[model samples]
Target chain A: MQEKELIPYLYRTEFRKITAVLCRLFGIEHITIAEDIVGDTFLLAAETWGLKGIPANPAAWLYVVAKNKARDFLKRNTIFNEKVSPEVQYSAGESHEIEVDLSPTNINDSQLQMMFAICYPGIPPESQIGLSLRILCSFSIDEIADAFLTNKETINKRLYRAKEKLKQDKVKIEMPSGSEISDRIETVLTTLYLLFNEGYYSASRNTVLTKDLCLEAMRLTHMLTENKNTDKPEVNALLALMCFHASRFEARIDKNGELILYEDQDISLWNKELIKQGECYLNRAAKGDLISRYHLEAAIAYWHTAERDSPEKWEKVLSLYNRLLMVEYSPIAALNRTYALAKVYGNKAAIIEAEKLGLDHSHLYHILLGELYATVDTQKAIRHFTAASKLTKTSADRNVIRKKIDKLKK
Target chain B: MKEFVMVYRSELMGEIKLTAEGNMVVSKEWENWMGGIAAQNKLVSPGMRLGNEGRVIKPGNVVTNGPYAEIKEIIGGLSIFKADSIEEATEWAKTCPILNAGGNVEIRDIIQVNG
Candidate 1:
């Protein structure tokens, strides 16, 4: 790959690995220091590679530089010696070498540990996600703010507060014990799901279809599946759900970056390999009796991957939506179910159900209503479409709704 | 071709608080800029970076703790490059990455004396 392409790819892939290793060495209190070091490593790569060309083994080069920097800092800072050295010497033994080990197994272990540390329950869920995006995914504050649909100041404050909380609580960087593991893993999975959705249904107008966040979420989740202690049915189900959705990534947006309604998307563009992998995970998820929301959602996503015009597909999807709402009563899920309701039952019945949900503030609700009323009542459809256009944030969504209104008026 | 010395001066280099990562980034920028000149066979000498510490001896045999204690700007480093003219050398200096960090490059023609 060219230097421009390789730098970013390495930045995304290696940022977490290097930070995790450094954080493991410096302890959680110095997470920012670790982040700074990793950032510097990338900046170095960008500058050096522009002249020297890409290194033969880029990962090793980063590890060595980061290790030397960390060592230098440790030697110079008396406070680190007093506070951190004892712990490092105890855990790693008295070897003066002070290796910043980034072996494959250690990398995996450190990441898993970092996941637990970031997802500590004391930190609010949104803050947890913010921390993960910043430290684990190598996202800039601006990018995290964009993901959160907020400004940089807000994200910066949130991350600052979260890091303070971690330090105050002295959160350890290790997987939770047996009983605690279940609860902690739930939070971790939720954070991962939100990260994936941010990428899948990105709020930013400029990067609606960027897949980096989604891919990062998937990469972290796959780490859970690989570990013996954390691997569970729900984990597989979430992976399956993500895989199913990712399979349609190509068909989700047009060249103009407008959202493509599922019915209008080209099914031929869906990835067959990802669909097969989703099926494999779904089958594994079905083995256990516990019916988590992930299982239901994965089932719904599975049906979405089927033949678009098939009645059986809609039937299965609608049923899964019903089950999902029973398990978790989110208005968004309820809003989505109304779409499936329209497909299986007629638009008339679905409109009744959709209107009762009282999601008046949501543009998606009005958009769905507009779609449902299109053939039945042109005037009502135009009204709903107009409302949706006003409620929408992005000009892309507004333009889409405006086009719908124009078509109906014609 | 004539030889020119390019001296890098920066006030911000001492004031800016850099983490290890930030230092790496700055180091990479320097490496890339220097490497570009080397690639073009225009580099006469890669030069050395002067540290913050040094001793200065005045003509009266009086010693001071170097670089002038109160000076805001310090010479961070210097390198020599072969260019056809001072204008060509200045053109190359314009691309120096140090300028991005609020630093400036001073280019002077290195006159050759009789051997």
Candidate 2:
């Protein structure tokens, strides 16, 4: 089949799932080799599929090829005796030999286990992220470095150290049981969220990496939602939150990659498909009695996306922020909530509320205050803008604030 | 696990490269490098940074200031990494930006009591 036609069927999602299963079946010591075998299967497919036209079942063909490769590799290693014979592995569409569950139930659990192993507490965070991207997302060390705005050498060192740590700790490939699984799930979700943020707020030339992180998060969440054991309300809520926020990606920035405040962005550019998915996930997330931060955040983002002209939506956003603040006292969330309050109420009331908080140390908070004061108090706005310009490190941000300050003088 | 302190030293004290807009580029780069390291969770707890008043203490007395050794030899800041062996620890030290600034990473095994 044409490469374009096969693109949809052949994805990192399948690659990660198959590789994780093989790695679990074999051992952690052979993870690199297992990944190599998986890569070779894809390479073979790329060459032969175009000539033969993709088989009616491409995943099965790739799986057969990969399984054979794994057996051959294990045969060479001597540590693991090859289990499956190449001939018996592929027997029509149905086979009892491959007991592995590629369904959401099985795949989600395996992927979550793999994610936790990569982000293991003992491993350095840099290595955690780099190894996760390389092992699970198929990102090269150079690509990971570029995503984090660092050199490839740094990424290489981190990956090596992370792998060594896992080896030394004798970390198993299987998922932890009971309460440990819950803790591991939290870490795994957090790692994925951080990965998304890196891509979203990345100071890179192309903002596409951010969207890639969002898609990866969604894919992982789907894996969780599919699994019977792992399909908790929080997992679905997290997916809903990501979908709602990601739906606005197109309107978040222009072709030049400059920041567009949420208010100034074009609502028409939102993705309807993603919005619909977000609503479905949100409904599923609400099935449980307990509310999660993700549930609240998704509800807030839905409110914004669902109604473009509703000025009262800003109040709902603030309320959601307040609820989120109760769950987690993050300074960033507080700063954001204060800004929304400034928009809803007058600047004086908002400024008084903001002054009571310790957010005066944040450059972003000062900028928001400056923006609130631009019309009423020019000199105070100028002072705050100057303070923010001095506090901010990004030249792009400084330029915008300086322009604003210059305009206020007129 | 072996702990290695990769000290990032600098020669210029307050000499910053200021842009036409009065932005300090060197300090910005320094902050970016530090932020990158911090992002990776390499920063150890109870970390202390020495400023202009830092002094070298000897067995008998404390030296204030004088024609100290080369300015590049002055320890600025340190990043800690845990590795299985000294060699593995040294490998991590090689990536520190201090080496690019004409400074060397001093590798010493951290002494600990087993009790």
Candidate 3:
């Protein structure tokens, strides 16, 4: 990366890592203070690096500066001095200087613990996603707003309320113990799954799906799979699911930035490396007898990555979608299953099932119906397509729907 | 080369709410300006950013709030540069990141007496 790009890159990677370590060191209740300190550290870095030119070892420079800034904060904040510091001193045990332990192992452990903390059941699921994005992913409030396609004021208020609740409850930044691990892991994985979707399904008007958001989600999920304490078959399955979807990211959009329907996508554009990684994670996910929604979804997504469309592929996809909906009865999953139904049983069957969904508000629902009706009922297909174009938010979806309508007219 | 201090100032406006990423772009701008000076080997001291609040004591030992507490414009930070003339120093100050934020630069000559 150029010098211009390096700091923001570092901010994205190192900010969360340091924030995790500091939040762990200072206590999660003072997460705001920890965040402020990290912010100050970067600002100081900005000033100092500008004057001094880029340091020989920028990352090391950052850690050192963070340590100094943190020490200053510890000394200056009397509340911490009176309450938090003594316990910290005891933890340090004989080292007069408080160790801002930035060791790789410690950073990894802290981040994993933070992942669980932010995704705690106590925090509402929406705020859990917000907190995870803000603290765990180092996303700014504005970026979170952009990610959710909401305004900053709404997201700001949401985050503030969530953080206030966290402090009041004194949520500990640690993995859930013993019997709680299974449920906690599920919560964390679900948040990760949603985070990935927030990036993947940037279907709203004007915004294209960003790779960074998806990569950050995958990075955190991969972190979970690496940790022995939190690593579960479900976690691996989630990673596998993310990997399979991410592999097709390039193929999903055209050069002009319009959405490419799955059937029209070039199979060659799919990332072989990610597909291999997905297969590896899937194999690991299969080790356990348990079949989470992610496992079923990963299997479904994995089939989509196959180079040649086969009857067998759609059959397996159809079966997995059936199992997935049984495990988790989401309307979106059901909508997707209708496509598999079309592939296997024919358009009429799919159209009948899809219309029953009555998801009139969703452009996807109308588009799906339009697609299913194209071969059988020309008038009905155009009606659904026009409805879909009207309901659709993004120009990409509008273009795709419009092209379909035009094709049917021809 | 004569030394000059570029005292940068800006309006004591309300906080410019920026995302961390947004702050970074500004930071990089400062970096570019500073880097340009350092590249020319004309930079003396990086100087310092004044704290937002400080005390002011008159000769009567009359303590009062800092100039920043009341002043519409406050000194933001300063940097030293070596240039042949004030005009040359002013040239360097023209591209200052502070100016972009609606601040201005005051160029003052540093005089040597003993040497």
Candidate closest to the true structure, highest DockQ: 2
RMSD of every prediction: 28.3, 17.4, 27.9
TM-score of 1: 0.73
Candidates ranked by lDDT: 1, 3, 2
Expressed as tens digits, the lDDT of each residue in A231-268 for candidate 1 is: 88999999999999999888878897778877788889
Candidate 3 lDDT over B1-115, as tens digits, reads 8999999999864554454444311354575356345534467776766655767677888888865646678887787888879998888788788888899999999878895
Mark the regions of model 3 whose C-alpha exceeds 4 Å error after superposition. Answer: A81-87, A91-95, A204-209, B1-115
DockQ of each: 0.00, 0.01, 0.00
Residue A3 local lDDT, model 3? 63
Q: What CAPRI-style quality would you assign to candidate 2?
A: incorrect
The all-Cα superposition gives candidate 3 an RMSD in Å to the true structure of 27.9
For candidate 1, the lDDT comes to 0.81
Give the CA lDDT, 0 to 100, for residue A20 in model 3: 94
Stretches > 4 Å off in candidate 1 = A2-4, A45-56, A78-82, A85-87, A91-95, A149-151, B1-115
Q: Residues A1-410, candidate 2, lDDT per residue (tens digit)?
A: 45776743475546877777776656666667767888888888887977877788888888778877866665466554343333334541254334444565555556667876787888766677777787777665667888888898888877777777887897777667766776777767677677766777777655766567667767767877876667778788888888888888999888887877777788899889999999999999877566777787788878878665466887677666665655555667667677766666767867765664556677887888898888779999999999999988777688778888989999
TM-score of candidate 2 chain B vs. the reference? 0.57
